[model samples]
Target: MPAQSANSTSPAADRPPAARDTDALLRAELGTAIRKLRKERGLTLVQLAERAALSHPFLSQLERGLTRPSMPSLHRIARALGTTQQVLMAAAAVPHPDIPVGSAHLVRSGEGLPVARPGGTARMLGAPAYSVHPVEYTGMSEEFQDYYDHPGDEFVYVMTGEVEIELQAAEGPRVHVLGPGDSICYPGGTPHRWRAVGDGSLVRLLTVQNATGEADRHHS
Candidate 1:
């Protein structure tokens, strides 16, 4: 199949009407994440803008998702929020499949809780999150405090655009470029990172993290 185009119709269009409301969905998800994190840190919009080196109005626009931020701008916001870019990326999501089979929960298109750091929106498929200081874990997850090595499995499936997941091995390092529908999974201890593969076009993924013996068995 051809590589998915960023300017093309959203993949969600082929799914259901509930998924078609993507533009607004993206903004709501991103805005909600920023607002939640800011409140958690007890910093008002003005203070956060100052700390982020962004203007108050622009920050407000960001919180409202009226505009998008470049990756560098997101990095600044992450630092100002006392978190990592990856954490903010994770803020766009929350999930743990260990609960049950068929819970009937639904996170709409581009409607994942904002991972605390800042980036693409995310909704969890499985694997719960850990708690951190100064940032309480509310029932509605929108961000992570930080990432640590823990016992669990990870699976990231590219749904749009392109990505490269680099993994370390005895031979040295390896890179796997994934397009839409491509996925990679690794154990918890394996160190890895995401890299841009092409035009740095926007990419989305269905991320699954499972911390259970069953998942180990499945992967093994």
Candidate 2:
């Protein structure tokens, strides 16, 4: 059996130093974001969990950064908080300084905001206020099974390792395996799933998503 990096729900002590740090930072950022949103909505933890249909203790752990939630769970929480996952992600990142409407922004390497994932880490590489949201996912495991369907145009580029992507397109379900340097782009509202494909070594990919669709949906 291939050795797994760490538990999907919690960080492992034996993980590489960098991975562990990423995990910890992601957890803390996510927790803080959730808590802040909940408070801003004037809802208590119990009320928010009830609305999200999640366990109260689980939400508590999430707020404490002791545990991480799956994509579906995070989506549920986001909806309950009257926001989208992308907006929540923006909140999770280091607060962007208020720049003028037409000014350019820069994000240095390793300065991107960390995002929690099941068996790996994802960083938000785009400025929070940008119209394009770029994220880098690293060390994704084979067990990753988050399927997404939302309003946005998404482009994916494989950086290292192999990835098997399953897309529910207009014609039918399509599965594609991508290697280094491969890329794919699809419109929003297409259900899709992707995971690392190999000896469980982990994979890295960069995804750039246009925020127009999601932003429209958010305000509508």
Candidate 3:
């Protein structure tokens, strides 16, 4: 047998600096957009942070692209910015597929806009003009227990790694551990959570949600 390399399979090794930098670059691009929008609206960082209910330091880091914000946090920020989350998410450096009336939407490889989140990065694939809201999430294995329920239906299909999906049932909570290629669909009204399994393992899945006039989402 060949000699084993030191920690070749470690999570840190798996996640190269280039990938991390790419994520950071996207965050930086997003931060620049937020800053430009904030300036255009004549709102100081303090004012905007207060309006978003986020601490100034946190907001500063976010504006500086020093950290990533979760989807909920971004939602709050978008509310403070007086803009929709989708609009802000669409302005990133990543190319967006334009799905117009009676038109074909084309998305070239590496054109998807990626929004970084806790333990994952989400890419918005569907537009407001579409009948469905689709986002692809890539997450690294970590300890997480976020739960929520919303209006409409949702579908999830795993593309890589493993995950444990927890769904709130009348009896209690049903758990389903899934591997690559597995899929699940259910109503968004049901409370649920998904957690990555195995240390350093990365999980990727596509989520499609109902895209009506508007959908109410309550997070816990």
Candidate 3, residues 1-220, lDDT tens digits: the string is 2212111111123556866655566667667777877886789988887787777777778778776556656766776775544445544444333645436444444444556566766776654345556777887536654565555478889898888888988899899988889999987469887888884247888888774322212100
Query: Which portions of model 2 show Cα errors greater than 4 Å?
Result: 1-44, 58-72, 95-105, 213-220
lDDT of each: 0.50, 0.71, 0.64
Report clashes for each candidate as comma-separated counts. Answer: 19, 0, 0
Residues 1-220, model 1: lDDT tens digits: 2211111112233646754445445555556677877797899988887787776776677677565454445656766776543344444433324434445334444444333223333233221233211111112112222223334466776766676666776787787878877878777556666654454436556555543333222211
Task: Find the candidate with the highest lDDT and give its number.
Answer: 2
**lDDT, candidate 2, at 10:** 59
Q: Over the stretch 18-120, how does candidate 2's per-residue lDDT look in tens digits?
A: 7677667767877887897788779998888778778778888889888776556777787787665665565445443454443765556665545456657
lDDT of 3 at 54: 72
**Estimated TM-score for each candidate:** 0.42, 0.69, 0.60
User: Of models 1 and 2, which has the larger lDDT?
Assistant: 2
Task: List candidate 3 stretches off by more than 4 Å.
Answer: 1-52, 56-69, 75-102, 213-220
Q: After superposition, how far is residue 134 of candidate 3 from its true place, in Å?
A: 1.4
Task: Order the candidates by lDDT, highest first.
Answer: 2, 3, 1
Q: Model 1 lDDT vs. the true structure? A: 0.50
Clashing pairs in 2: none
The CA-based lDDT of model 3 is what? Answer: 0.64
Instruction: Report the C-alpha displacement of residue 207, candidate 2, in angstroms.
Output: 0.6
Residue 207 error, candidate 3, Å: 1.0
Give residue 121's error in model 1 in angstroms. Answer: 9.7
